[model samples]
Target: MLEQRGILVPEAVRGRITRRMDPHVMRDWFRRAFAAAAAGQVFGDE
Candidate 1:
């Protein structure tokens, strides 16, 4: 979703997301990504 919007997903952010263990949190991040302008926005303070 971020890619479709031309938002860049940095490696650090990718690593963080990839490192997540909770499926619920990951699912929330996926939903948030649909509306995020940047990859960081998907995780926020996480």
Candidate 2:
């Protein structure tokens, strides 16, 4: 959706995220996601 709205560039999403998101928040989010995956939690199944 954001890509279609031109808010995100597909090729530059990684760099953009790093530049736009707070580093601490991003790190925390990644940690949670990884932990969930490791614990065998299924994503987007609700």
Residue pairs with backbone atoms closer than 3 Å in model 2 (clashes): none
lDDT of 1 by residue, 1-46 (tens): 6777899988887788778899999889888988887787887856
- Candidate 1: segments with Cα more than 4 A from true spot: none
Name model 2 segments beyond 4 Å from true. 1-20, 37-46
Report, for every candidate in turn, its global Cα lDDT versus the true structure.
0.82, 0.41
Q: Distance from true position, residue 41, model 1, in Å?
A: 1.4
The per-prediction CA RMSD against the true structure, in angstroms, equals: 1.4, 10.9
Model 2 earns a TM-score of 0.33
- Best prediction by TM-score: 1
**Candidate number achieving the greatest lDDT relative to the actual structure:** 1
